[model samples]
Target: MLAQRAQLPDGRWHFQHGPMDIVIGAHGSPASVDAAHAAAWQRFTGILDELVQELVALRRPVQGDCPVLGPIARRMWQACQPFQRSFITPMAAVAGAVAQELVACYERSGVTRAWINNGGDIALHLEPSQSVRIGLYADIARLGLDEIRDGILTDGQFDVSSVLPVRGVATSGWRGRSFSLGIADSVTVLARTASEADAAATVIANAVDLDDERILRRPACELKDDTDLGYLLVTVDVPPLEPDRVQQALRAGLKRAQTLRAAGLIWSAALVCQNQIVTTGDPATKKLENRRAHQQLGSVFA
Candidate 1:
């Protein structure tokens, strides 16, 4: 299928083809910004087709001697390679890889700042002294419920001048578009690259599990025919749990996030399960402690 592009009312560029949908915003000289958009569109046009060419390999578990011809597919493969011993497939990094690729296109055009948001996985380009604020959704599915009606949902504001290592952000949960193996309401991760954040978010979200019978799971393939997880059990529903149980699940995921952070696979992570939340990373980076509404974004540094 051919890729389609449109300019949103608010001035962002939207590109979509197949399952990949991206929204991009850039700031710089008008000439550079326009060039970046053109480049992004050029790079995005054939990406879905290239990925489809290697769909079978991308879906397979990473192992010795697997070959893929597409650059983005290779990026996906490399991103998931660190977790090869696990059940991960290159597909786990698809969204982030796409975001990263598009952001790279923008960077080459000399944009001072840009962000490519592929679904909820984001790749950011921040020139020195420029920064952006990001909205953190504690639990997207529960955003509008009475419990969160107070509108106290906190938004994370990052100053690129202070925390330069982070350029990618991604979130995962059972309620998200993708199937998850754990009960985390949301698991957001930051990394040097969007691909890493995407892979780590999936892994951390999967680690946020407990043996509670109230959680519902089903074979992933049964829910989606082309799911990379195949027959692996994926969380389908999570019923209300005691506060203590929520903490237990969040702690489990926290341990995994800490390990990944120490290993340099991730910069930081915010994990939420029910009403409980845990964060691991550099303390200097801003964090959202409590949030009640759906995610909202605002600029922290102009």
Candidate 2:
């Protein structure tokens, strides 16, 4: 299918091609914004074809030498390389890598900031002295048309300035667009790049699990014919869990997030399960032990 684009009433742009759907917003001079939008569209048009050509290699597990050739495909491979010790593929970072590529178009002069949201994964561009405030939605199952029509009641929010190393945000869960092996309601991550955040989110989300007879699972191949997970089991139904059980699952994910943060793969993360939330503690990657004194972050479960 051919790529298509439309301008929303709020002045943002919506672009779609095959499975890729993106919404972009920017703040800049009229001429600069127009130019950036045009450039992004041009770049977006051929992305699907480029990925299709290297689809086989992209679906393989990330190990040994990189197998993809395209720029975006290579970015995806590199992003997931850090997590190669586990079962992960370049597909885990595809959405974020594509958004990051399009965001580059708005990095020129006169454009103070720009954001590209590929589904729920996001990539940001900020000039010197610029910053952006991001809202948090911890649960995807709770999202509905009323929430969209009346503006989302954010669970929390945090501000990212130019000085901070964060420029990307991503979320993962059993209820999200991608298949998840854990029972977390959501796991949102912040990192230096969109692709890194996406990969880390996937890794952390898979760690938020606990054995219970009520949790139903099925093989990934049974649900999606081309899934990279092959015959691995993925969460399908997570029955209402006890409060203590939710905390147990969230703690598992939190440990994974902490490890990624210590390795510099992720800046911070917020994980949710059954209305309970756990974060990586500090957004600046400092004072990770003092979680209660988190001044730079707000409650993500609100």
Candidate 3:
């Protein structure tokens, strides 16, 4: 029932278990697909505990390498290595790195239609005739702007009518399960892979912020035990954005999404703020029906 897609693994090398909020898959013999999934989980299981155990070490200022024991940890170090020239922790890029590694595993195994998803971030390997549908979360899921005046944005979960062709979806916002530095209610992104989409979502969500007191804010750590955003308060609440201010915030995120798309890092971005929905992909605003109607149709690409 959770809005996710993951295989139930049985074999073992290590790292695969639980409803890991994310999953990777490929189209092949049930056996082949199962083996591939087993391998991925074997690699992922216990990584969270290991990472948490080493969280302090992860936070310390490392001049060079922190060569940890966990394979995922090593990957995390390498991902952040590029930014080490500055001061980014290996954890900053951990989500993407782990996803990339798993995707690489499935690819090496010769699986055509394969994917590795982490929570919402993911990596994918699709075959011909295969496509994915991703949903966008309104940043101001609570912000009743014109949607309230116009009676568009309702106070309820988004409903997807009928199933769609999409196999991947991710949502990032200040109000979601994870953390966001900006003020967007939700920013959903879809791409060929989850890692790219995940990274891009991070980039875009950061764009949907009100630079002024236009919105309340705090440090990332204040809200969570350990957040990639060290000193920045995850956006708390928006007092009340003027019509123009809302447009400006949405515009900034759209502009940033364009840059990400141009870089070939993102296929499309769906930025939702309160009631204003801005998209740059197949699932455009017009294509989306009202929430209740959508759920009836089953708007999932899984």
Top-lDDT candidate index: 2
- How would you order the candidates by lDDT, starting with the best? 2, 1, 3
Q: Candidate 2, residues 1-302: lDDT per residue as tens digits?
A: 78999999989999999999999999989999999999999999999999999999999999999988899999999999999999999999999999999999999988989999898888999998988877666656666899778876666676778898999988888888899999887787899999999999999999999999999999999999999999999999998889999889989999999999899999998887877777887854232223222111121211
Compose the digit string of candidate 1's lDDT tens values, residues 35-151.
989989999998888898999999999988758978899989998898888899999999999999989877754688999999889899988777777766555654565645565
lDDT scores of the candidates, listed in order: 0.81, 0.85, 0.56
Lowest lDDT 10-residue stretch of candidate 1: 292-301
Q: Residues 151-237, candidate 3, lDDT per residue (tens digit)?
A: 443322332222332333455677756667777776766544444455466667878867776677777777776566678666777
Q: On a 0 to 1 TM-score scale, where does candidate 3 land against the true structure?
A: 0.66
Q: In candidate 1, how many Å is residue 263 off?
A: 0.7
TM-scores vs. true structure, each candidate: 0.90, 0.93, 0.66
Per-candidate count of clashing residue pairs (backbone under 3 Å): 2, 0, 39
Which residue pairs overlap in candidate 1's backbone?
153-291, 153-292
What order do candidates take by TM-score, descending? 2, 1, 3
The deviation in Å at residue 68 for candidate 2 is 1.1
Kindly report which residue stretches of model 3 are placed more than 4 angstroms away from their true locations once superposed: 1-20, 24-26, 49-92, 108-112, 137-170, 191-193, 212-214, 281-299
